[model samples]
Target: MSDTESRLGMPSGAGAWDERSERWLAEGAAGTAGRAGEAASGAEVPRAVPRRGAVDPVKALMHRHRELCERAVDPLEIAAGLEAHGVTDRTAARFRHRDVFSLAEEMFARVPRDGDSQGFPSASPSASASASVGREWGWALWALLPGALCAAAVAGLRLTEGQTRLLVAAAGVLAVGLGLRLALARGPLSRHGAPSAARPATGVWIGWLLGYAALGDGLLRTAATGGPDTLPTGAPDGPWPLATAPLLALALSCAPAAWSARLLAGRARRRLTSSRGLEEFASAVRPLLLGSFALYLGALAALLALCAAVLDEPAGYAPTLALGALLLLARLLTAHGFTHAPAVVLTACASGEAIALAGVFAGRLPGCGFLSVPAEELLDAWGAGSVPALICAAGALTLLIHAGRTLTRASAHAHPTPSP
Candidate 1:
């Protein structure tokens, strides 16, 4: 055996097979084909070898395929590669499936815990994994940058212009697109064949894009009516003064969060042993829930603090509070399914409707706006027309339950044993 093969745990004579077994397989195969083809063709037709893509089948067997499959390399592909490269394995031919699998088991065992060798197992698994991790973190920062800027814009710069808000959202979209491309191009996440079907199809993406565009247009139209720096009268004029700025920042932020989740989930799926994968995933749910809560609360508190400092009007505090609360709820809830379209639509629509209802009440409250009214009057009015309040309460409770369950799972993972 070659030093490389021995190191890979490949048997000393994997290429050897019993002469009798080889003859038997060859004879049997020809006869079987001959019998099967008798009704269609007078003689057996020769098989055509496939050398799909640019890589030679021989070289692919030597290297790349192992990387593609990770440690779970396929035995049949090995058998075919051997046949295509004119190396014979009597054990592989006679057993057809068994011997190749036996070889795969040995090769998989020989595979270095960290990819180190060039032939039997991938030479770059560790490097590829490290690269993937680096890219994920880099993309996370890509997501963080825009969100931080948007939050700052809302708090200090005063995000009042519709076009500027669109531009921010566009930058987020661009980052998400670039990160996704980088993830798919090299190492760790790829498949030997086509992409995984678990992700949404192109049509689904198109539909989502169309829906988001329509939502953006409606928001733009709403802002246009106000004609910049003006309010819809009684609507909160502080903290996201244009009313749609929070929504725009939120919509933009979803791309990064979703991208990160998709990458993390995919990594977990690809890397973890099936036995412990679900358990680990459940553990992660709590951290995600906590992070989402922290993000919402932190952003709201910071923005509210800035509004108090910058606006310098006590009256400005109330509207800012109302706006901040609604946006916070929407952001926290929608984050649960940010990686998926259907979930995004459902969470967004539900939260958006609830917040819009609050806006409606504000627009039509007696004497003064609902948000502008005193707390006692607002509570009394809520008591008088309590159906909407009930709906909002139910939705909020549902989301709370989800968050609580996620936290529980996280806590379970964190404290697997009781304290003494």
Candidate 2:
């Protein structure tokens, strides 16, 4: 019998082989006389048979390869298969001259094109639909942005002097809104399995929100320092409202960013914990650098705006403005992409406060001596006005020092001392 038939215990003949086997079995049972007769007649003893089927060798190899790649099984069988096929002399030889996992990935990557023959789904219109929806949502966010600005402009016209009571009332409302958001955020987050990265992102987002709040708070403090008469002062007055309005809007916008950071940080932390120590530290540093760059750019924009308003020759300021703006935006985008660090948070806050100071100084400086009020009154106004600017400057300096320390520490880690 052939090797396959012998192994399977099956007759290697037509369907009539069953009858022949039965006859042989009968003949073999006839004892010594029959044994002598059988030897003369060239008869053979019979046995029960088993079923067999052809198993596709390639498909089995692919399945086993997948199992090994997924770490679901030992790779010994796969190695044996390769050796059996003479694909390599040694069972220890690498398959396809590549890591099993990498080979598996490549193999599966091409499977979709095989149209289900390789057990992969073909590309479909659903993917295109998702892409379309994402595009629409992105465009929609910016579509009504101008309308919101217009509304803020119209509202500013009515918020003139003697509206100090109204301004205080607005502050009260903002405080309440923020408080509600905080209270709501507390419940879910307290029980969350959120990751460490999320914490930093949360810190960064909170920092950004705080930065905007700091800007508005600084402006309010500056306005308050001017007394009731100093109302409607600063930055096209309309633009000031725009700036302030965006703070609330930005605070709300930060929610999504914070949540995203939390999810990402958690994933990153898990991945890093399993990795080499150096790689883990490098991963964390990426976000800090990114956040730092963003804060820098935003600060730069505010500075340029102040320069444009306050300087005599503003023509040459455009390039500086553009560069600063790009840098700030780049910083934000990069920080958001990577792991957020506390340093980036502090950096952003400091940059924002500095920009705000520039704005306040721009609006208040020249007018210091040119007020319609008496010279003595002008001196008093300068003294009062300087209070807010000084506070802002102090805050900016604090944040800058904090961020600087973090950056320095990070730098130190990146360049460890060598042992003699």
Candidate 3:
């Protein structure tokens, strides 16, 4: 066996090392000898000499896939290409890597990024990601449409009365829904391929959360405080008791949510290209993730304040802000293909809200006042909005923790196969 093959533990055979690699290694050795002779002759060598007996196992693989690595935008793409060609985590071990991703990353790092040598203009990773994000900026603008529609509907609701108000509100909700669908259709939030089974369940839970916020919360509060056990139809002289602040805040938040998601995705792709290891990538991305989330929350808070001012409602309710944050985080996770956690968290939050309302009603039964006591105390201490706030805050916290772990992985951002 040749020295390089022996060091790499490859058995002597034609399959072990290709002729091209042998020639390349021979040329490299000759070049190294020439450099050493020049150094011996007192001519300065610009680069240090590699150790005499050292051999990089990945060098051959890197050389073999030079074109692939040079053209790749990120390590994930290289990993995907390697995977497509029958490379697995087990195969990666042959190159002294933990997995194909690690092997691909090493190869990507070794390859020169200069496109001039490859006879083509290559965009820098950051520039390419930014260009891609700029192309989709329309989604952010579209996101504003839903909020505008809802705000106009709220204005119409205030100006109308009785059946007319209800009609306006229903029409506003429909328009907002359709606008939201359009906004998410082509952005980072767009879902690819066959919808998962959990999608229907996610929609149902989302509907429940919104419905409860709009009406169930008020009814539950009224009943807990000893008001009549009845739904509030729109009073002719006043606006409907719908929680417009949360709805308005959430709707207005679509723009920031889309922007934040795009920002994070672009930054993450750039980080993937620059990060040297998985741990490095995670460390770098965690801060970007937190920053994007915080930016969204700040934007949501500003919108909530505006809504409260225009609607003449209290702006201090934690539930609305919590729900907005929860929804944004859930959407962000889902956008990145982490669907299960968001669905599970949303369901849990919805169930919690339902159970709280149910328990309050159950307490209304004779001798069952204990069930009502706890909920009533919470409402009395923090107001009725506290129920959804506490539940949604807990759910948001859970999703944030889950996202920190799952979204940091390289595989989460990779699209290895075409969606059917």
Candidate 4:
């Protein structure tokens, strides 16, 4: 049957469609088949209406900018996508040209409620520590240069001045440098750097004196016995122990001083916690008190023992021994005072120097039997001559201690609120 007849009608005894209806149906079917084929090929698919400039130009620029940003930012994208509509090209570029950190923050802020796509990155601890240590070392080196130069000058002078003057100057410079370094390291009294204030200055001073005595003794012995090159200094039988006896006596005298300092340290810590300004002044002095007592005890015992041991020698040596002990004590006390109790340390220091001068005067007195010179007369003469000196020393110490205290109070008043 023709296509039109098949579509139109069915014949009797064998089904057939009418020709006109079949032709109309065939045309409709052909049209549908053409459309279906076009749809399958995407030619007849519906197109989404394009809104004029709907895609942000800033976002396009940022995407392009990543080519540069990617080189710098390894694991993270530095530039962020711009979403605002009316921003100028320049403004948008500036916003996109931020660091990875800024970009990350911007992205985080923009993507509110987005899971796991926002927040600041973790800091690199190792890198940060390295940077901090590097900076600290740089500053430390700069500060140390002056002290190092002073030390070098003193050390180099030994050949020119003979050992005595050179040694004295070197020791003085060393002590001063140490004091300065310690002060700087501690910082202003308002902000001391050390954690353990419980360590009394008095105790520290005693220890320092003992140690210094040992060292000085060893050096003197080395010089006296043989050239330092051939000497075995580290041996226990070394000159240090022998030299340290007088220092030990002085130290023993200062034993009670250390305990007193410990008490002072406790008080200071309490005051400091309350944001008191006098923390440093009090802390510095408290230690000195304890150290003074210790020094006194150590020095007395060491000196007496030494005197007994060397009794066979001329009795005059007793006074000389006393003089030497006084000198070491004076020096150690001077250093400690400068560090922690500038006034008291200085007064103690001056007294020691006076004692040394008296010994010198006695030694030089014409026809004055050096040992025969009564100890009392010697002391009286020194007191009479050194009266003004003693007064000046005492006054200076008093002023320093007083000023330090006043300054602390003033600081406390200035910063009423404690720093976090």
TM-score of each: 0.34, 0.29, 0.72, 0.25
**Off by more than 4 A, model 3:** 1-74, 80-94, 97-102, 105-134, 192-198, 229-231, 235-240, 415-420
Which of the two candidates, 1 or 4, achieves a greater TM-score against the reference?
1
- Candidate No. with top lDDT: 3
- The residue-level lDDT of candidate 2 at 143 comes to 28
What candidate 1 gets wrong by more than 4 Å, as runs, is 1-130, 148-300, 311-420
User: Which pairs clash in the backbone of model 1?
Assistant: none
What lDDT tens digits, residue by residue, belong to model 1 across residues 1-420? 432222223333322223433444466567656656774866655553332223223323434334322322333333323332333344434423233434443444533333433235343788879976896575455444544544444443244345665565466456544444443332222221113222344324323332332232233224323323544231245312233343333434434344433443343333222212224444555455456545544554455455445444232223323333332333233332122432343354345434543453454446545542332243345431132233334444455455454323211111111111
lDDT of 2 at 348: 54
Worst ten in a row by lDDT for model 4: 410-419
lDDT of 1 at 268: 31
In order of TM-score, best first, we have 3, 1, 2, 4
What lDDT would each prediction earn against the true structure?
Answer: 0.38, 0.36, 0.72, 0.36
Q: lDDT rank, highest first?
A: 3, 1, 4, 2
Off by over 4 Å in 4: 1-184, 187-341, 344-348, 354-363, 367-420
Tens digits of lDDT, candidate 3, 1-420: 322222222223343225545665787778778888999999988875332212656776665555455555566777745654567678887777777777887777766543533344556999979976875666667778878887888788889877888799899888887787677665665543222223878878987998887776677767776765444675432223567777888888888887888788879878877765566777898999999999988888898898888788767557877887788888877766668889889999999888888888899799988887777888889888888889999999999999898777655555423211
Whose TM-score is greatest here?
3
The residue-level lDDT of candidate 3 at 140 comes to 65
lDDT, residue 370, model 4: 65
